[model samples]
Target: MKAQLELLSKYSGTAIEEIEVLFKDNPRLQSASVLGVNIFEELKTQINKSQVLKELIVYINDNYSVGDKLAPEREVAEILGYERSTIREYYPNLKLFGYLDIQHGKSTLFKRSFEHQIIELVKL
Candidate 1:
């Protein structure tokens, strides 16, 4: 973990002190690392997930109209070049953000324009 942090510090052009300050500011992040999680990798994964989520939202907004039934998760995943599980994982987030209305058995429907919801998404 020390090595990973050092690599992060070097590549990110952030000093060790600044990294320590960030850890101090976010206790959960610090505790996660203490519990043996690779903090750098975890952070990288989260950043990547956020980027993918944004891409997915943009794709949906540009390609489909409100109330349109979306393709199945597998088909959407194939079209987006992501794993089916990845698309599935973001379904709840889409619903919560008012981008989609997902029903258990029925097809998912595009719920609203992404313009307003995108502001909230960036905070996530």
Candidate 2:
């Protein structure tokens, strides 16, 4: 199912953070994620559960300029190659993993620390 942007929440320049990031892997998670750089963690992002996910991350970094309002889900899906539902499924897990603010209904405001960490994760 496709997503809409009418439900977006206002941004308040908040820098959200999550302190609970587990190195353990779940069966439900993509294999690439589970097979990430296990030896030198703490700064890993493991973004390759699927190509769609990898695209989603890069799409966010490329499109959402700071101070630019969040794009609607429809636009996001086009760039991420994911159905809205799929992206939603990833959000809660990502939030727990350290994605700062999930704003504009279907968008994410990546945290610097999380960005640094997840960037490493995706690269792996």
Say which candidate scores most in lDDT: 1
The stretch of ten residues in a row with the least summed lDDT in candidate 1 is: 35-44
Position 94, candidate 1: lDDT = 72
Candidate 1 Cα errors over 4 Å, as ranges: 1-49, 116-124
Candidate 1 C-alpha lDDT tens digits along 30-72 = 5555443344344335435687676677678778999899999
Segments of candidate 2 deviating more than 4 angstroms: 1-46, 66-68, 103-117, 120-124
For candidate 1, the lDDT comes to 0.71
Q: lDDT by residue for model 2 over 1-124, one digit each (tens)?
A: 0011111111212222111122124323323333233312432333544555565666666655544444665667766667888766655554555544675544456653334545555655
lDDT of 2: 0.46
State residue 35's C-alpha deviation in candidate 2, in Å.
19
Q: Count clashes in each candidate, considering only residues at least 3 apart in sequence or on different chains.
A: 0, 2
